[model samples]
Target: MRDDEFLAERFEAHRGQLRAVARRMLGSAAEAEDAVQEAWVRMSRSDTTHVDNLGGWLTTVVGRVCLDMLRSRRSRAEQPLEPEAPVPAAVPDPEQDVLLADSVGSALLVVLDTLTPAERLAFVLHDLFAVPYDGIADVIGKSPAATRQLASRARRRVRGARSADSDHVTPARRRELVDAFLAAAREGDFEGLLDVLDPDVVVRTEAGVTTGASAVAKGAATYSRHMVGVPVPALVDGATGIALLRDGRVERTLAFTFVHDRISVIDITTDRERAARLKITLL
Candidate 1:
């Protein structure tokens, strides 16, 4: 075979691995395929006369390309995930794909979205890809200690969210609690809602235009107070509820977490702009 033929064959052999890495980074299968195609083009045109360890070099190139793609795609602060298309029964189940599109997968990705770019990359490489801390440092251009620090913050957030159970409740059970909470919120049922909440249940918000911790607690309380008898409206889907005060319109995003039979936690981020888009009403 000609020299060009050998290179072409090599590309075909490792292309699947490259696509997987790109998909992992990009979070979109279509984008990953496109990135790999572009990488192959760059490889074909380059002067590779002295190139060694083709696979390692290719891996590096693919990772860099993916990082670039991820940066460009970062503007959407809250990424609404697209549902997987229905698969034919004849086709064997795609276990990995199923995992990626399931409730747990969605939960993980949503939590990951809260991390900083550097932190996200570090956590993904270390936890998701099983990359060593030293190598993760290399990819993220941080000292191993710094890399570990980033992962530390990310891990803490994940664990705190997961362990938020006031009572022992599995993930599936917690999801149901969230549904009931949203129902009460929509209907404005403070008594019914508070019934499910521990008297001292924690509700807090991050700083912004909205009132500080004291203020949000009062607002949520007021919501229940005014609507004491009104039934909270039905919440859609009920995966989990996130509230934020939009920068311009609403006072905050009121995100919630559920545990056992009660609403375990409430986190309100005061983003007035997001609130405006969400069209949340504030009394």
Candidate 2:
């Protein structure tokens, strides 16, 4: 085989793994594919004659590409543009798609969205993929120690979000918390809102992210005063949450993540297109 053909074969061997890393970092399948393609393009043009581990080199390349994409994405407005039609797959595999989505739970994706680009890159690479801190630091232009700290912070946030599934927090109790949150919001009860929110609670929406219990509670109280439609309990992405219905049609959805008995995260979906895509089952 020619030298180029040999290189292509090696790249194809790692494509699946590279795509998985990108998918977790980006949270968008299309963007992940783009990042992988960019990595291939860079490798095809560069001289890797001295490279010892091809897999590690390619992973670093994809990490850099994903980091740039994430930073660019954050620089843009919070309101995403209308999604373009997805490119047709050369060979569609619905099962593979389902498996990938299941592996990366929807709640986890929501928590990842709240992280900064650098924090997300460090955590996803080091914690999830086991990429060493030195390599992650190179991708984000930080010292190894700083990179480790980034991962540590991200890990804490992720743990808080996932703690909702702890055995101690029964599904019934979670629902009760959600019910209390809605009741407080509807009543414009600021103190009640604080009672159910974590001290460092985070609320994410297309508009932007708001942190701190007092801040989120203040906003919730203000929104409650002019709120329209009835908010009802629902299952959002397999977790207990709230759905706002107007004239019998769902207009918004809020997914909650509890740490201990207080809510730590609130992922609100208000964009019409995004809201329509959420799996919300009214109770």
Candidate 3:
């Protein structure tokens, strides 16, 4: 085979892994495809004669592209958090797509959206994908210790949102907390809302990020008073949540992650396309 053909074969072998990494980094399948394509373009232009581990090199390229895309999105305040369209298949294996979707559920995506660009990359690469901290530091331009810290903070946030302690939180328990939050919001009870929200709770929306119970409560109060449709209780990506329907279609989705009976994170999306992408079941 010619040299170019050899390079193409190697690139194809790692395409699926690169696409998966991109998808997790960017919440949109379309964007993930773009990132992977961009990586290929860069590799095609560079001289890879000295590269021993092509997979690692490609992963680094994809990560850098994803990091740039995420930072650019953050710079533009109007970008929506969730994106429409099914994530393109990394390979032709249908089973792989199913497994990937099942693994990266909506609840996880919601929580990830709250992380900063550097933190998200660090956590996704190191924690989820098992990339070494040193490897991740090179991608984000941070010291190994700092990169580890970013992943550590992200891990704490993810754990707090989705705790593994099976004893305390049941489906019914989660529903009760969500209902309580709605009740407080509707009644414009700021203190009541705070009572149920974790002290360092995070509320993320298209508008921006709000941290702390007090600030989240203040915004929740306003949202409650202006709510148009009655919210139906539901499970969003296997987590307790709610959906507002209009004309028999989901107009809004509110996904929550709890820690020890208090809400640690709340992800609210009013964008129609984004809400449709979530696995929602009205109760």
Candidate 4:
């Protein structure tokens, strides 16, 4: 067989995943197919013998290609393009079925269209596919920190857009509020801590529940002083939360519930075993 034919076969093996990534990023079947084809072309032209992680490499390439396409589409001032193919009722393969279900949804696509190219790519790749920040950084040509911010921004926009008709807090505002609480706790600023908490805030811990702003603030001060590691911003089940990472693993997770721009409830998960099982990606 020809070398090109062998390469084509290898590319075909990853076609499903590649298409899924592109489809989510571009939100159009025709554009997704074009992006995947472009990725294949690039792979065929390069010597990939030294590529240890072919799947990851392809994903990064496809992601970058899609990002470029999104920028180009924006430059033209065009509307959000629709899928060229008819929307299927169902996909046979379960893995792809999940991808399709997750990617599709009129409300989500509308929200996704509002994001900038970089933000959309960052959110879709990391939040949706669990691609590491490092992998995303390479594609977006930014530092991991910048990529994290992009994803966070996109996540906030998505959340706010989805609940536009409601009272959902913007992602940026949520982070800001959470950061203020953390900062207050870290500094042992009792009043500062209470400032960000709702008057009747409730904190659920493994031991029991604590109520009232002062009580919650006191507990936060104590915990912050003894926190094993730095508390990093993260998306916990689609809500902005904080995760404490020690020795490269999550030691604890504090999921927050916000009301009227104040923290209403803090659901703390301190079970080391259970904490270790969480799929956390630091923002």
- C-alpha TM-score for every candidate: 0.53, 0.60, 0.60, 0.53
Candidate numbers, best lDDT first, in rank order = 3, 2, 4, 1
Candidate 4, run of 10 with poorest lDDT: 83-92
Error of 1 at 218 (Å): 20
On residues 201-248, what C-alpha lDDT tens digit does candidate 1 reach at each position?
Answer: 445433312212243334555665554233222221332454322233
- Report the lDDT of model 2 for residue 191: 94
Error of 1 at 108 (Å): 5.0
**Candidate 2 lDDT over residue span 1-283, tens digit each:** 9999999999998898888788778877778889999999999999988999988999999999988887788666242322332222223478755544443553245435776778888887886567999999999999999999878867777666555456266788989899889889888899999999987687877665677789999999899888888898999888789989999888899998778788888989887678888888998
Model 2 TM-score is 0.60
In candidate 4, stretches whose alpha carbon ends up further than 4 angstroms from where it belongs are 83-111, 165-283
Instruction: Pull out the clashing pairs in model 2.
Output: none
Candidate 3 structure quality by residue, lDDT tens digits, 108-207: 4543477777888998787556789889999999999999987876766766644535526677888999999989999999999998998768777776
Relative to the unseen true structure, what is the C-alpha lDDT of residue 186 in candidate 4, on a scale of 0 to 100? 93
Give the Å error, residue 235, model 3: 18
Give lDDT tens digits, candidate 4, residues 1-283. 9988999998998888888788778878888889999999999999999999888899999998998998787666444557444244222567865654654563244324555678778988897668999999998899999999878766654554444346677889999998998899999999999889977565655554465688788988997888788799887666678998888878889888776677866777788887777767678
- In model 4, state the lDDT of residue 192: 97
How high is the lDDT of residue 84 in model 2? Answer: 33
